[model samples]
Target: MTLFKVAQLARTAAARGSRSYSSGMFTNAGYEASREHARGAVETWKKISLFVALPSVAIFSYVATKDELAHIHHLEHDPPKFVGYPYLHVRKRKFPYGDGEHTPFWNPLTNPDPEE
Candidate 1:
């Protein structure tokens, strides 16, 4: 081919490649914008769902277990009275060495103190 014709062909090819590249870049930018919008929508929906669902669950749970909750509150506030058995009597015993009148003897061989 002639040198002029080859140069012309190269110029046309370069122009076509540049146009295609610019169009592709625009398409990519459009896709990025779309994806960003989708992400924003999803995040907004998540926030809305959380706001709606948490209160709904809390209200439903409170309503469903209201009786049990009241019972628990009553139990906490007014516990049952404890009644001692007639046969189980607790006696307060005096320690032998506690008073000055009943002083301990200094016998080291036998451990006389019940605690020791």
Candidate 2:
């Protein structure tokens, strides 16, 4: 679902909160009721987010892990389709400042994968 739809659902849930704030100090039952409502809303949002997030995470991991495994297995073939989003790696190259041809510009040992 869209973000606006999610926001609308959250707003609706918030509107359903039990008891209204009065000018006086909050009571124990009122606090309990408010907490309960908030907890319910949180639980609902958690389920929705998991449903949306888990599959995408699985797909991303599958594509990434498969590519890494392919490399380890001495397979020089290009990774399968969907392994990378289009133009995801299209960025300006950063060359070394000096003409130190002996030095590698980017060090994999020191530079962590941007994906991580």
| Candidate 1: residue pairs that collide | none
Error of 1 at 43 (Å): 1.7
Model 2's alpha-carbon lDDT is 0.66
Candidate 2, residue 66: lDDT: 94
lDDT per residue as tens, model 1, 6-63: 9999999999988775554358788898889999999999998899988899999989
Residue by residue across 3-112, what tens digits does model 2's lDDT show?
99999999888887644545332688778888899999999999978997888899999999998886756433432333455765455654466433223554444333
State the C-alpha lDDT per candidate.
0.68, 0.66
- Evaluated with lDDT, which candidate comes out highest? 1
Model 1 vs. true fold: TM: 0.33
TM-scores of the models, in the order given = 0.33, 0.35
Instruction: Judge candidate 1 at residue 104 and give its lDDT.
Output: 57
